[model samples]
Target chain A: MKQIVSPGCTTGPFFPVDFSDGSEDLSQRNGLAAKGQHIILTGHVLELGGKPARNMVVEIWQADASGIFRHPLDPRQQDCDPGFWCWGRARTDADGVYRFTTIIPGAYEDRAPHINVAILGIGLTRPLVTNIFFDARADVVFECVPAELRSRLLAKPEGDGVYRFDVILRGENETPFFVE
Target chain B: MMDDSTMKIDYAPYDDATQTLRQIDKYTPSATRVPSAPLIERPLTLSERTGPTELVSKWNVGKLDLCRLAPDSPRALGQLIHVTGRVTDEDGAPVSSVVMEIWQANASGKYIHELDDHRAPLDPNFTGQGRLVTDEDGRYEVFTVKPGAYPVLYSGWWWRPPHIHFSILGTSWMNRFITQIFFPGEVLNEKDLLLNGVPSRDVRDRLIFKPTDTVMGDLSYIGYQRDFVLRGHRQTPELP
Candidate 1:
């Protein structure tokens, strides 16, 4: 029998060093304070067998506090906060924990406040995309997800504007992943 | 609604040959095997469409050279190289203005990162990180030194082939992908498990970069070409 390799595990053990300013902190630009309520998002990434997934790259991108993006295509670019980084990246530690210091992204048009997530590493055959919605207005988005999987998408608020959202890559209670 | 004769039956599970055939599904990579859940079929929302834009600015300083962190520092030592390539969709259309982040170890197999505890001497002149945006023609080029092979203890005592990690951010969130580029004719290509993880020989061949004779003045810098075909359309069927 031929050996069957795991899918989505094609790319590497990418060690993303800080290439540019604001690469790790979305709440600030280089060292300047960004406009919005400062928040620290923390979580752990686990494998299907419940083992800590280490050295995996986790990237987050979100709109600024004024509900605007910094892209050239976004018409609402005028509302973008000049000091907001709007993006951040962190690799999991030995225990699979990754954290980012960013603002609570503002809700746009019909969608609630959320941060888009992308996970890449050796274990993944392809990049995994998901979203982390703040618990404040999560009900609006939660209604769209299946009842059993809705809880996995919500990030509970701890004190001091801190939020927690753990990610399970596989197994019985895997985190909800969105298709492209 | 009660057409019993037209209904599909499950009698195949009772046969020995059918049971063997059913096991083949386990070998294929699907949502059942991978962590990615099935995409919920729904129309795009405003937040999903307009947000998650390119956060890095186009005027970012030092977005090309990977070897030196500052102009005052001494230049990194190794064979000077120019890595050039084009970013295109599966249909052969150009993908312009996309951000590509590349990082790798130094020529001595040592990384400047704090987590890299390799005993190799660190090169003060080499920072090992760079970023660039594809031009209108979907072309990008970078100047850096050839990185040396490094040992990855987790994958046995063997050394990892010299390769550069790439993180590509396309127009939309769905178009985002990450892959590595390795030099051609590296003896360790056949031994590296991560490179071997790509089961298809043709797909694996696409990852390697071949050297070209293109020279820059009297600097004697090496030239490498490796094009990228990002996810977009299905592969065209081959003629028999």
Candidate 2:
């Protein structure tokens, strides 16, 4: 028994400020109050020639405008208010560029009006789940979600509430790893 | 005298790091309820994996996968993990028990799902997924739930760091490894797009973070060690 050469995987840390448990009364539902989605959300972590990725660890997860899901079969909702932590975590200080301050989320019907982004590249093995739209509606949620996730959606929407979503991680149409 | 080669690990201990971030807690991965509601009587699926493959045969475990511990931190309830690991193929040897399955993101990445909304709060110890079978040299273990840290929005903006997600199979090996482990200096591994998709920097520095060691009396939770080989034929079941 001796044929090992399969070791090389890292990239896991999209949200671990110790697991931001969003609590403004569970992210305030119905009455509204879930809007602080901060946005330093820079970009650089290059490598495929771009060059940057200093330390690595940029995780982020969303869902609070009533769609409900801080987690655990529907955590009931309404808990992240005062000072707001709609969910944020960062790790890229050498130049790879990573920042956070989250909140801007409020829309969920599940037909085709998406907002579910995941990156977990912290140590690297696999995880880049992509999905961030709102550039005045990216072709109506990419012609109604589900064409293999409508081409990973992201039509350059940077109007203050911020939106860029750049993750080429590894060549030719790369960035799409979602099973959870 | 439980010796199949003598292996055991359960964790807990780390005073600072924001008190280990309030003792890790976040699990919300629901495709939509049934995890437990007065429901306990099923476990008997043995083995199966068909279609669309991200490999989710009802999240596997069978025999009703237990679930009762929740009294309020009885050392963080039952969760479960016996993982031994050591299944050599392609060229390596060992290859005994085999049959493994794992899933993560519980310490609080939210995953006890029914279609996730991300509220966070479910560590009745953590189940995430487990079903062991590997010990002779190709060790294997399972106990479940420690995966917290969930958030990501990239290009547009947001972040997440702190993770765990694994799945394995054997007998010519089926292959599936979405690996993750970081906590040593955890500043959020440079925008974590799967650690920038590992282009290599000494293997992303071996996926950062590792100081875990517990086993004195056993309060449970002695994890954060990593290993995954699978590269003999590359099954191509899909979901890398």
Candidate 3:
């Protein structure tokens, strides 16, 4: 029963961002790379009218290759991959394409392999929450998603460890969103 | 399930009551991103339950103080204020260790960023960015300058009221609330598009923080308090 206390505002046209330190490349830390299939996750964010979202911040968090989370709340936090940064960030380009160099996350308890995403832009009004599933695996949450909408959550593998996942913020084929 | 122990991922579906309007008039709907389709709802699960708690180490360039970019830097040019708040759940349980951040314009309404084309002078000592985590009691305090209002070049170029942008990462990823904190009685609060976009007047008022009498030794600052209420139960799960 958590209620909305305050409605957030738009970021206008700018905020603070410094990605010069390779934060977008989450596949490796220092010189040691994470233990998993290195992959290129890239996608485009579009508005309902097919206009490309420009210069929006895109963040992704996922489990390591062992299906273990690095979060304190996870029961298996201690077992996480030491070399895995476990967090990635990217901003949409002029074409609205955001790219991240990450590892394929392992499936956790009752969930399929996936990466959680949060997006914010000048006109987004509010942050949008969603996930990029690796496949149509048998999972509780994936199955619970309305049958017709689950496809929007699944990422398309475009060969050679490269995946494509597009997000449509509103209107037809709007990527399914969630709130806990 | 797994090692038998005991745990359940209670999926929380989308609750529109507390959710922001996806298609608020000019504020959200734009050519680049609009609410052409209704939000398709789904149940929250492990994907949303577990979050990136191990932040700060990577993104924290500034700790709790925004009044000065660095310890030795001169005080930022503006009225210094102390912002304190707690993150709690619906049942009034403290949700500790929440990752929080604050970003705002300088006292002159200009951000310390490249995209800001506004003519306001940038305070070399004020980066306008600070990052921190709620303490064990789900409480946090940040020392920053009262940000100045800037004009939004949307249509007729209306001026946005002075506000602080807050990004909250609750226990769960889905509770990632990105909002702003406005000072009570700001003249612009009545016309701010994003603030008034909120459907309820009572809830809209919640966005404004209350003034409190606070002092730190010889240095006194205008103190404000606002508590954020997130969703779900917060008691830590019993370890197996």
lDDT of each: 0.67, 0.40, 0.75
**Best-fitting candidate, measured by TM-score?**
3
lDDT of 3 by residue, A77-101 (tens): 8999988877777888889899988
Instruction: Give candidate 3 misplaced runs (Cα > 4 Å).
Output: A1-12, A19-22, A145-151, A171-173, B1-19, B28-34, B56-63, B214-218, B234-240
Which candidate model has the greater DockQ, 1 or 3? Answer: 3
Better of 1 and 2 by TM-score: 1
User: What's the TM-score of every candidate structure?
Assistant: 0.77, 0.25, 0.87
Ranking by DockQ: 3, 1, 2
User: Which ranges of candidate 2 are over 4 A from the true structure?
Assistant: A1-10, A14-94, A97-180, B1-84, B95-104, B107-119, B122-136, B146-240
Q: Rank order by TM-score, top first?
A: 3, 1, 2
Clash totals in order: 6, 123, 3
- TM-score of decoy 2: 0.25
Each model's Cα RMSD: 10.2, 22.8, 3.9
True contacts kept of each: 0.18, 0.14, 0.56
- Per-residue lDDT of candidate 2, residues A1-180 (tens digit): 434333333323322332223221223334654554544345554444455555455544455444343422223434423333333435555776665544455554432333444444433333333445544443332443455544545535567854565554543444443322
* Model 3: lDDT to the true structure: 0.75
DockQ top scorer: 3
At residue B148, candidate 1 shows an lDDT of 88
